[model samples]
Target: MRKRFLVLILLSLPLGSFSQDINFELDFSAVYWAPKSNDTIRISVGNNGRYIFTDSEEVAKSFGSITRRFQPAGGKENADLKLLFDLKTIFMLMEVKIGQNTVLANVDLNQFMKKGKSIDSATVRKMSATPTALKIENNGKKYKLYGVAPDNKPDDLIYMAFNEKYPVDYDTYFSKLMTSATGELFSIDIPSGLLVHVEDSKGEIILELLSIKKKKQKGSANIQLKLE
Candidate 1:
């Protein structure tokens, strides 16, 4: 009877744990700046009490070209196959604020690399951005704004300020914004010589711009294109 009772308890434990709902919300925001050209990118993500996924919006304007890539938690390469964003540089810059304390993360892209790429320990440490007020140029006008935040209030305010400073069609902007936000493996091929900004909800920011110059040889093209 004692052994039978113990089995019943053990079987019930899994059910009890599964019965409890684990609900969580994650809010992310980011701003990318180009010091030399003076351009900025601003974005925000709101996860509605579901820790599994979130919704995002991005607004970008620049003189040249910019490429944006999105990757979720288990490395960019491990993203769901159905998602449409490029998995090449699986890097993300993410911040999580559970309450008052915030945890900043910079997911390293090298971890997602398949086999032989050299891994730099220093690169792993370089992902967090210090919180600060930043000056940015949007649509040929200058605006001072805070770096990234974990709340939508500040981001909404900045959006309003941007509209006031430079008049543009918000509807068209929003349409493009939605496209960029939905695709899991999408990449924007920006023209060269243009300043760009990137914001991500997943606390991993892999700045591919700096690493863009290295041209891959023909032999390595296969590995780079392998989506899985």
Candidate 2:
């Protein structure tokens, strides 16, 4: 029987200042496969990432009536607070509903390569070791970083892509929180910017991004995020 996989992706736009609050929409899909099982999970994000609604009746029941959102308990600093709050909350609930056996192990680069997966060994190692410190490279954008400020890239891709999309402190607070002695908040080493892909090195999960985009209702037309 072919083993099934799961993928988890976190994305957020830098906080942008518009004349008026705008309404944006998010579309997410998750595909699950087993020897005798094949199902597609679809989720719609509304209310500025505060509400997550599903089209599947069975899946909806699984999530329960409780809503998942970022209602920081106060004074508690988390690196992925704003960017991954909704998705993280949903995943935590899943671990409880689906049982621990279904939960994937911590991602390990060496173990993944041994399994015959093709990816940048050195780069993945760097990212896995120091996600905050390492940079993601793709589409002519080399060594892209997420931090208090942007790197020396003439195009300002990282900043322009996220700066106005999410809160400014999202990166600043996260960077500081991650470096604290208390330790990292997220289990995975995620670099900054709008993440479009993820590889669960443990082989338990293999999530792919179907589509991720942002639409402006009314605001200054600016550069949008592009991940290829």
Candidate 3:
């Protein structure tokens, strides 16, 4: 009788209760829609929520010559720029290391954002004013990052979008991740925590959530796509 009771209790417990706190991973890559060149860039985001930037501007410039003119000043060569933020606000710039280099990220802000004491609608507006950046738009099926024209009107400068077939519970996390990813790449802000749909040929640089991998402890995963 007791043995039967023990088995019943185990069966009644919630599913996945054991593996909730273990190793997890998500891998995202950006690839050109064109099959001719078919160049792909891989970005690795760690469990601690750190998004590392490898190459953004140069890749954008390569897509089209027009992007060269919108380069953010300072010749900021972010070969391996590991920029960390609060995940809530852009002002909370945390210092993290990339190799042996000490990242003076605040200095980079001068070229991209208008520094202020508090984060408000006004500050966000100023930050979004940079021409090189693209704002992310989240529709139900996909995400779009569009740009504004020089005269403050909508322009077809950069039209990029990618899919968001991720889990619903992780929606918040993905939104913030896309925000930092875009910011580090093109100095933009994604107010809505939703993302991805890469399209068109307007010389815009953005990332798409290529793949997501999850696992438990004592397990690891690395997804790689070699360029030809």
Q: Residue 157 in candidate 2 has what lDDT?
A: 22
The reply for model 1, stretches above 4 Å from the true place, is: 1-22, 27-228
Strongest candidate by lDDT: 3
Task: List the candidates' TM-scores in order.
Answer: 0.18, 0.26, 0.31
lDDT value, residue 33 of candidate 2: 22
Residue range 1-228, candidate 1, lDDT tens digits: 111011112111111111112222224333544444544433322231111121122222220121112222343231111011112223233333222222223333233222223322221111112333554444465543224321222342211122221122322222233232332222222111212233343422322122111111111001011124
Backbone N/Cα/C clashes per model: 18, 14, 6
Residue pairs that clash (backbone atoms under 3 angstroms), model 3: 161-197, 161-198, 161-199, 162-196, 162-197, 162-198
lDDT, candidate 1, equals 0.25
Q: What would the TM-score be for candidate 1 when compared with the true structure?
A: 0.18
RMSD of each: 21.3, 18.9, 18.3
C-alpha lDDT of residue 177 in model 2: 29
Residue 201 error, candidate 1, Å? 25
Alpha-carbon local distance difference test for all models: 0.25, 0.28, 0.32
